[model samples]
Target: MAHEAHSHEHGGGEMNWKLIVVSAVFLVIGLFLDNVETFRFINPYLVLLIYIVAFMPVGLPVMREAWEQIEHERDFFSEFMLMSVAAIGAFFLGEYPEAVAVMLLYCVGEGLQDRAVDRARDSIKRLIAFRPDFARLADGREERPEAVTIGSIIEVRPGERVPLDGRLLDAPAAFNTAALTGESVPRMIETGHEVMAGMIATDSIVRLEVVREASESAISRILKMVEEAAERKSSTEAFIHRFAHVYTPVVIALAVLVVVVPWLASLFSAADYAFSMWLQRALVFLVISCPCALVISVPLGYFGGIGVASRKGILFKGSNGLDAVTMLDTVVFDKTGTLTTGAFRVEQTVGLSPEDLAFVAAVEAKSSHPIARAVVEFMQGKPLATVDSACIVNVPGYGMTCGEWAIGTLRLMKKQGIVYDEALNEVAETIVAVAHDGRFVGYILLADTPKAGIFTLPQRLKAQGIKLMQVLSGDKQALIDKLIAGFHGHGFVKGYGDLLPEDKVSHLEALKKEGKRVAFVGDGINDAPVLALSDVGFAMGNMGADMAVETADVIIQTDEPAKVVEAIAIGRRTRRIVLQNIVFAIGVKVLVMVLGVLGVATLWEAVFADSGVALLAVMNSIRPLHRPRFEEK
Candidate 1:
């Protein structure tokens, strides 16, 4: 059967394509008429008539957007209002070409701003495309997908997106999570693995009993967050709103005064000079008064910054959060899953020789388990000989093995008539015991190890003026103590173990109270609340839970701890560029407006004042795209 394409009522890509084509047509017509000598002989009035017709395709939409804001009782200060009023006034002064030039240039600027917004929104829309549309049931039935409403259950087969929030009902499966995490790798998931929607199944088909419907799933919530963030205005946008609030009505009042006062003054002064000269000056003021730079480039800057961060695997909840990250002075990290690998590994192995150990290791490696992978990673360089064995078994939270040579939990060894040896057990690190033909052999120990370069990360952060480094985890005190001991006297390295999700939130709140900028780093379903509550959150992408990545402000795509430092540097550099753009734009506009009011500038100067500043601000706003600073540890 041919599958139907997923449809939405939102009219995706249609309006954008129309805007692009219309903008292109207007630009071409304006350029052709301005350069053609044949058109120069045409009355300037007739030429403007043609130019206004050309401008309508782009100008009508701008007018419509302004009308919508007015209808919704939103503030009446918009760039469209400024452009429309200025062009009308210019025409009244018999400057038809100047009127057309003002509207045409303004149209081009609006088109560029719209294109940038569309690009940022398209990035988020691509994220939404990962939603699954079909499910294959366990009863040999394929089900037609329904709308992703709240509380709906859906089934997912191997190589399909998990359609809803669910728990595994059958054996373990492997999942390729590159779509959500930005890590191009697959992870193994066993029974009771909290599976979220939008993850692709890689190996083995396992049944997932849906708990939350597709709409209420994590992916749906994340999509909503991203959309809200894109729409949320930055501080620069707020300033523009306030400026327009006063600037628009004030300009209209000034234009009225210029018309009435000049006629009033005509009785005392030369009448023709007062009428023509003051009216011309009023039109020039109107052209210069338009806040085109603020209206066009401020939102573009915010949108572009957000888009750049998303490309680097950072998910800013809103422009507010994106701006906040750049201002942060200190970044706090949750230790267990953020800085560490978050999985157990064989730190050391003892007792048995290399040959004997390989046989026991092969028996334990037979099962699909996290501990099994840890053992394999530990024995990476050691020679291993395969042993022919049947009756391979797995003990949950314990161990596994083949035949009489059993490698499993301490309790399993005791049950199998094996004697306890404390000295050898301490040396092995993780609890792993072996039994050969119903006799006790030896065991191996494992622990969750720190990620590469984690020990040296604090030094780099301190050099960047990050004053505090704290490790908060739910792991037991013994493990936390081990981690603290590993980093003793390394620039305020401390650990608080056995913290619940709520406890972590409380700790972040306290840090905020102390006027400290805190950034939480975590992975796992339990860390979602803490991630959302912190000033900024960074999640470890590889092996991280879906909730962590979605909640985090920044996601480290690679396993290296050094990326944390690099991300901070990127944040600072982007912020510097934003400030530079704002200062340059506002300063130049003020100086030029002063000169124009004193009769030192003309209508052409006004055009350059409005459009040139806007263009420069836009160019500066996108500087982060080329100069992204990555720190080397």
Candidate 2:
């Protein structure tokens, strides 16, 4: 997965502290001269002069934008339009202090929003920073990561980050993968194991042969996914954006009527109508009508949630995936490499002598299947004799053939007309039958252990109101039943076995037909179709295939089942915060606007309605940024 350089473009630039300081000085001077009789020697116009200067720096940018909205973009309903109109109207009405205060408060609010959004951007920026700038070569030469070529060896010393994705060339070493996976525990990697960039060498210095360029490394991909996630807005965010655009123009029209209709009506009647007062009231209405709160807060809430999830090693490709997780009623998980460790170990061997086991190991060594690798690993350190053999042939969905013998499934032996005296019954474990010259030699039993987190996942999800907890696998029904039996107290509802890849997709389709929003979790190439077909797809990042990464909506970098629970919790919290902001912003703005229309609310209250609510909503949006505690790995 090659990634382009991450874009660091934020909502806006850093706060203009110099501008703030100068404006504050002018405001203080204006206030002192206007209020203090001791300063009466200064002309009133001089005080107004100070105030105008104060307003220009902080308020000019906003007024300019409002002007551009009308003159160029033809967008007259912007918050800037409302604020600029209100502040200038106040100046015209001889409310000089109020006019200066209005724009000053708006500047403060804008500064706060800039800071809040920058904080959210920092969440992913910190991850991008994990990519080491330089790598120490095998010969003690330090060079830029981007300059390192493939097959070049690099040395990662203790406490130093691995610079690129590569194969370990040194002895087995422990590396801390928290930067990439968010799991604090160090993982031990064998000499030939593939090691991703961004992991720190925790125990000893390790040499690695670079397998990927800096841009194509795992860290690059993770950074790319997380940074781009903000582009995918949730339904709530999109609606608020649309609402703001439409709401602004309508409010402007209403503000116009507030000024014209009442003044016109008063001219035809006996009611005392001061045009200035009515005009001032319309200005207050404009201030209250600004849609800044809803526009700034809603998206911040989602981005905050995404930042939090990234810290937890969960990469939600978009806000849509984060949104979808909250709506999941049922989560479907693949058996291998998901709930259970995909690595198999030879548990037991039946009716096999030392020589026979060695011969089988030799035959299995010629193949690269996981089952074969398990057999080879199990036979390690054993004094086994290697037999000279002809071409090794692989039988799809069955086993492999070596010379005049076959080592594979019992069905393969049956297909080859090999008979065994042992009564073979389908069980929860994997069994590979070995034959010699069309005669049963022996069978080796292999088993994959369930991940530690899978034990408690079912019960936790059940407690969270997930109604049906099930496992779908292509393994035999007897094995699936046995695995399901162990999960009795864990709240597993059903187990579907003897399923092909398409069968899994069909089951998900059926669930969708039943109105169940399903999230499928898997890490293999075969899981790609079902992963894409599901409502939300969770791919185990550590061992996941390229296809899975490309298709799955969410990538769990740590490969922790507990993260599934964490993701759901994150989504729920994020959605809650988003709703809270929407309701609070809208609720506060509506109340203040009604009060402003009735002439009960002042310019001060209007400022609060526009900026205060925005500040509060932004503060509430960042609640998800707090680090969470997960079960021990």
lDDT of each: 0.66, 0.83
Regions of candidate 2 where Cα sits further than 4 Å from its true position = 1-15, 68-74, 136-143, 348-369, 372-419, 432-443, 489-492, 627-633
Residue-by-residue lDDT tens digits, candidate 2, 1-633 = 000000111123454656766788899888888888899899888888899999887788778777766786677667777888889999999888778878877777777776887787687888867899899998998999999999999998899889899999878999999998888788998878899999999978889999999988999889888767878888887898889888987888888898888878888998887778778778888887777778877887888888888888899998888788888889888888888888899999998898888888888887778899999999999966666656678899899887887889988988998887546854568889988887898889998878886767777776555677778999888877777887774454578899999999899999999999899999999999999999899999988997898799999998887788888888878888899998887898788878887889988788867888888888898878864652212
Model 2 CA RMSD to the hidden true structure, in angstroms:
4.7
User: What TM-score fits each model?
Assistant: 0.73, 0.88
lDDT by residue (1-633, candidate 1, tens digit) is: 000010111112466446546545654666567679877775656656665775565456556655655666574655556666667677677665576667656555544544444554565667777777665555656654344343334456677888776787778888876555555667777787677677788776667777776666656765666677766666656776677677767876775676677677776987664565666666667677776566556665666666665555555566666566666666666776677776888765657668767776676566567777787767778877686655676666666757666787887876666777756543324577767788776667788778887888777777655778888888776677788777663558877877888888898889889999887778878888888888788777555777787788766655456666766665565556667776886687667656665667777678767777776776666655555554422
RMSD of each: 7.1, 4.7
Clashing pairs in 1: 152-213, 428-445, 429-445, 429-446, 430-445, 430-446
